[model samples]
Target chain A: MCRPLCWTYASGVLAVLAARTDDTNPLSGLVVADRPEPDVPEGWRLVRVKAAALNHHDLWSLRGVGLRSDELPRILGMDAAGVDEDGNPVVVHAVIADPDAGRGDEVNDPRRSLLSERYDGTFAEHLVVPARNLLPKPDALDDVEAACLPTAWLTAYRMLLRSGARPGDTILVQGAGGGVSTAAIVLAGAMGFRVWVATRDAERGRRAANLGADAVFDRGERLPERVDAVLDSVGAATWGHSLRAVRPGGTVVVCGATSGDPSPVELNRIFYQQIRIVGVTMGSRDELAGLLAFCAARNIRPVIDRVLPLHQAIEGFAALEAGDVFGKIVFTIP
Target chain B: MCRPLCWTYASGVLAVLAARTDDTNPLSGLVVADRPEPDVPEGWRLVRVKAAALNHHDLWSLRGVGLRSDELPRILGMDAAGVDEDGNPVVVHAVIADPDAGRGDEVNDPRRSLLSERYDGTFAEHLVVPARNLLPKPDALDDVEAACLPTAWLTAYRMLLRSGARPGDTILVQGAGGGVSTAAIVLAGAMGFRVWVATRDAERGRRAANLGADAVFDRGERLPERVDAVLDSVGAATWGHSLRAVRPGGTVVVCGATSGDPSPVELNRIFYQQIRIVGVTMGSRDELAGLLAFCAARNIRPVIDRVLPLHQAIEGFAALEAGDVFGKIVFTIP
Candidate 1:
């Protein structure tokens, strides 16, 4: 899956840029440009990009959160798989945190930042990352599939494994068709959880069944039985239903709030029912490794909505921004 | 602590009753009465309650939330230390659940209810509870302190232990002077957590320091450092502060919503900083047993603000209603 770095970057390097922010028109800031190669910091390795996946985080960055106009001309992609300088096939761990600070889990570090937040991201032909962030890419998953795992899949993985969920329990994934929701459906099903999904779109709810969800409900549709946990990423749009879906003493795990803040924290319901609300980030390297093994063992392939050549990546971003993409959109560098 | 069952209820049992519900004036519902003794049902034991403690739950019952006009004349205390029919000193675990349903944890049982919710409670000369609800009281804590444990102190205990708080962590107890807050300060300190407190009253802040809080801050005052967890019972008044006080990956353990529900669940902070909000109700029988042993072993007696005779319980309830009481208020039966 390794692509020659210099072929695409004839003069310098080709990268997708969120050059500035316009909250009303986030895509207006995006620029495809040829730029100087990023200087590798000490203890960091330069990887020749093979493939990368898009995330809603990129959209958030373009909206001036996590990425700012001051940090202009920033490349935007957190999940990537490529060949390191040493020629080892590897996946880049996007989070930059002192491992010691997080007690061996980088995601828990207070000062943690993801790729493109403070550093150049994987949209380029070559990218620099902490050497320690490299994980041996599994043989089972191709570069594009491996690229999708670091951000969305890893987040969903943590929501299941680290969010205190046990096997043989039913879990409600808040959205039916987003990257994390689709990943969670497959991962949770493979891991023996009875997966249920909620969606406002009837079509998406039906499509969710093909992704291995045991049951699908219309958004806010009351269920006959309470679930043991809920994996929520679609914030304000689904928080109340997420809280209501779980059983007494069950957990509601949150990784993202795409729809913004929810109304009424529902303190009364929380304490009365003894619900546990856990906030999850991307994941730990150890968990990423476990996810890799888990996926390989179960033959769990992440759902890919579409694939595009790196030069056509802007279309992928536009499709994602329009919410037209169901699963992940991966860009393969020529 | 072994009181004779027939002594107090010689004719009819003396009890405090929520005779009716008045939202505007909650205390108007409370009445001193000589009511018929509750017959011990199958798998239940009759207890001659030697000491009973008050909680805001009693106030809520009178406010027509937990109790209704149909369940009028219901005894209202959830905490009691008494002598069972076998004459063994015991404390009542107020939660009523079918042990089989919760997988050995009664608090997790969906059908679980507190004593006063659907049955006669411990504010009487005699009360009946399931046999499993009795835990032999340790001699170290007398009837008054032991009675305080099953509801407030055990709630604090569970909030600390079951809420994912670790030892050697700093826990901020919101509100310096409530029964649960004071209990949290004492228990968290004895359990090796650095205890911080937030309160508006200067006198209560000083009093909290005396209760083993390592530091005290005015309510909503910005702290120099984030805490590992926050014990929140103050609800809306301190919800934002509690969310702000905990570090990323830290917890806000909620057991009550006295002030009201927090508006706009801070979903951005919850997901962005990865904050956990764990809800804790009164603990399980096993946890109550551990709390009993822990308090006895540590010589940690609950702070009682005042003790009133059963006949003068109205005055005690008034002090609680006014929020003038700093610690637990217990009623001793003659």
Candidate 2:
């Protein structure tokens, strides 16, 4: 049996991880206890996890949105920075797409699954993953900081670069305080794109400006002029405004719609103005590598709102659910 | 007084070019008569029109959708193939953007306007336009055929190449027999891409197969597999199918929506799968030149469904509105 760790559910409620005979609602039945250690498969390595970061996806996992309870007692973490048995420090790329599954980009494979959804994740003291998932962590980043790079930072990096913005071009980042939005503001600024952020929260707008935004606007407010591109992760609520903020022949890259989906699409505005709306998911392993290199080369650091001991992970999940954190909440294994 | 050949719109009847005016739609009140020839501005040339093609935009012009009644006696055609005063045969590229517009590509310019919308079009025996709009026509293509290339064919070329299908990739052209769809199927085929077409009419599907479609399917029928890209011009009715038919990471390029706009978007499918949807309006002068060279080099011809004398234009518009033609309809002049 593996050494147990914490898991979260619904909102703030949390429980200790444990083996359950009834696979349904694994988190509900979780109770901390000792279990046999995981055996690493060939071409995989056993990572002695030093840190794991909590993402909104983890809470969703606990609510069993993406995972069946049968996959339960499932380890629930996507971002991990750890040391190998050989003692090399590394960061794990969360998306696990089968290389041979689909045509073209591996990230597009329908069969792909992130860690903790189909496989046990990095929340525990030790976890097993395909060796290919590992990237050497930059020495400049501590375990907690490096743990934030794989999911949110990597997604933000790809959305900015691959969505067709050039250096010196102005970009409007929609819904500013989320993980990807914050990452986009910092990265676009570093890459020489003028960054303007929109947020409903006045304080978050101020925080974005502090984080190097060229300008900050109240959510849904008209800008002085149209921009070259819009980085949109806020869905439904900001969809119309995002479309309005871009100039003709400009692009809007959407990675998520946290508010809701199925917004009214202004098709006339889309076609008549020749605006492009591109959809992006979390990025690929290659993109994660590039992101790591980019951040490391430029000494870019992820914002970490709070760090909790692994045993105190319940508090970390609570912080995320309360939406009180400015950045990521990480759990360090003692 | 200047002589102007004009169409008059009367109650519940088709607009007809008349020698004398009667009370009706004020914009169409002018009679067909001799007009003083327009003076060519510097950097512009006068073309003695040998042929002009009528499009829906022309009919819309007659309906006063884009022109004012005060702008009546307006010559109305966006496409022309003619000889300049120097007697060199040329095709006029219809999009007239500001020459000094700031740009990476001229298509990105905000001040761009189509001929006949903001400027007098090419319907008359003589028309004046900027010299840059003239693309020398190959001797092999007659004036009527050359007239068809500027709007529909150029839009198709830009949508296929610039909208991101690499040669040898597979594309699903939604709606088999419109001007743009036919152009796309033929151009994509000639450019070495595997082309599949979707149409509601079985006969049109068969015709698409004849026009070099690798395969043709019923509208919204499941393709054997997803294509690398989809060319969508039929907007509302087929937008969802277009989104579904493209493989993850593939693109859907739209030029028009003959059916209507504001189709329900499958935003969940789009973002979850990482799809791209781009909107293209028309082509640039340089793209028109490339398209001309491509056709000239490959012996590619625009498919003409019917050719009529300029006076028989009402019949052409009737056939177009009736949706009976499989390809472009051109009007010839003596």
Candidate 3:
């Protein structure tokens, strides 16, 4: 039988079946039971989740983020690809911001919150999201491929396209083997950009080349020529290198700092060379739609390192924590 | 006769002088002597300076910036408005970069260097600059008014227009009393943007309002609403407030750091809100030309706090160092 509530904890606790009333480790507690699967709430639709992918954010949530111990039994997971009750396969964009909340651009609204923060998110057997967040999954892609896109893939798409880069531009992707970096390399290569990869590990560099990077280099290795833009997520360690690798008037887009934050900003280089540093989060629903269409039209498939049954999610999380995966680790549900 | 070389040094040492033969202190070493006036080089024009502006940068040059004790006998000033050899009034653009030195956009060239750093600057009674750097001064404006541009005015123009701001946008000008902030307030006001000024002194706040700012606030005070962009030259101390004052997806354009360079960056706000931080330098020749045309067409007179004779330049520098002037302090040649 499909489990109702999914509970997660930091100390090797994995997603498990639970009763609606039972709550231990209240912060990580969640009751996703079969208490009348969510019905369409006006503009929202009930998606019977066929698959949902895991992100680092999901793990961060389990460790208690933006959720108090009193707000127990909160649904977790941000990326979902599933079938609506009408039996149509669709992908759910994870960012759950209201369109009417801001003056001009909805993305500019400060009150906006993503799924799993203020709202119950995916990972449930049945998930209901705003109709606008639902993009039809391509007939060519299976549920697993569609599930891996809403967070990591959407972030990579916006970072490359919306950050003022054009085709035939040269882009440096810092940290080669992660989900966003991998996606950026493939997307930039497809867009006809000369994509260079920087990585500390030689194995990751080789993998980046295999994933269609034009060239690969060690983390701080000098390039033959400066690039037009740099996609930097490895924060403190690669910040200086990102500044040095771009040409004058170039841009560096930063999404997350997995290594650390608080890097020494080289103000002299920034002003003297007229450099731009742009910060991006996951994209909007409109951008997510565009990304899905672009991927479907271009036959671009997300790189999936492994997929495991929902019951075996602990193994997947362990693999992720061990840093043994090159791409996304997904969880499949019935 | 104007001194070909002038010299000054710590502890009664003779320093700078300008002469046909290289002197140890070109600005301070040699006495005034009769020498042949400079002729315009090819693609250049000789400007017989009627008025020259003393910038803080000029003071820094006297203290040695990109200059050695060996190359002491050098010309100083970067801002000047004078008459050409043909007796046409002109304003000299100080940045002397080779237009054809780099690939694609000449402005993006790394090899470009400013006047005082490389070639002779505007301090002497007469100086030669590239012909393109000369903009015709309107007969309506006097030499002192025209001389206040080139560096500070051009920089402010580019920071407002070219730094990702549209008309009708709202911006926060951090540090309301400085050269760039004062210029930004006037320019942004004329261009139809709502401008807010932030400063430590309440008196400076009133002064900023008189300069055409819509509102003024105490430093680091929470704004009623987040602005579309922020103009930040005061780093470290005001960096946090600058970042906080802009809405999500807004921009922060930085040119200098009177406070300090490195600051504690709030990386969470940056990434989650998708803010853009752009570093700007002095404007290009084309930009300077646009600024000249804009001011001339609009009849905008630069704010001049005081004027001093060229011989009393030390007093001008002293006033600038005291930071009490409301606007630019210009030095006029007799």
Q: Top model by lDDT, which number?
A: 1
Q: What's chain A's TM-score in each predicted model?
A: 0.95, 0.89, 0.87
Ranking by TM-score: 1, 3, 2
- Candidate 1: segments with Cα more than 4 A from true spot: A1-10, B1-10
Residue A179's lDDT within candidate 2 is 78
User: What TM-score, over all chains together, does every model reach?
Assistant: 0.95, 0.88, 0.89
List, residue by residue over A1-334, the lDDT tens digit for candidate 2. 2233443433321223423433243244334433347778999988888888877676656655577757756667888999988999999988788766656567788788888888878777888899988989888788988999888788889888776878999999997667788889999999999999999899989889989999999999999999989998878888889989999889999887767674456676776678888888778888888888888889998877889887776676666656677777888887
Candidate 1 falls in which docking quality class?
medium
Worst 10 residues of 3 chain A by lDDT: A17-26
DockQ, Cα level, model 1: 0.72
Q: Residue B121 of candidate 1: its Cα lDDT?
A: 86
True contacts kept of 1: 0.83
Considering the two chains of model 2, state its CAPRI-style docking category. medium
Query: Over the stretch B1-334, how does candidate 3's per-residue lDDT look in tens digits?
Result: 1233443433331212233322233233323222235567799888888787766565456546455666545556788898988899999988777677534435567877666566666766778888888889877679998898888788788888755777898989998766778888888888888999999988888989999999999999999998989998778778889888888888889887766666555666687788898888877888888888888888888878889876666566567656677778887876
Q: Write the per-residue lDDT of candidate 1 for residues A4-29, one digit (tens) a residue.
A: 22223456888887878878778877
Chain B TM (all candidates): 0.95, 0.88, 0.86
- All candidates: CA RMSD (Å): 4.2, 5.6, 5.6
Q: Which DockQ values do the candidates obtain, in the order shown?
A: 0.72, 0.52, 0.62
Q: After superposition, how far is residue B170 of candidate 1 from its true place, in Å?
A: 1.1
Q: What tens-digit string does per-residue lDDT give for candidate 2 at B1-334?
A: 2233443433311222322223333223323334556778999999888777766566556656556666655556788899998899999999888645635567667888888766777766778899899989987788888888888888889888755777888999998777889999999999889999999999999999999999999999999988989988888888889888988888999887777774456676787788888888778888898888888889899988888876566667667666788888887767
Query: Model 1 chain A — which ten-residue stretch has the worst lDDT?
Result: A1-10
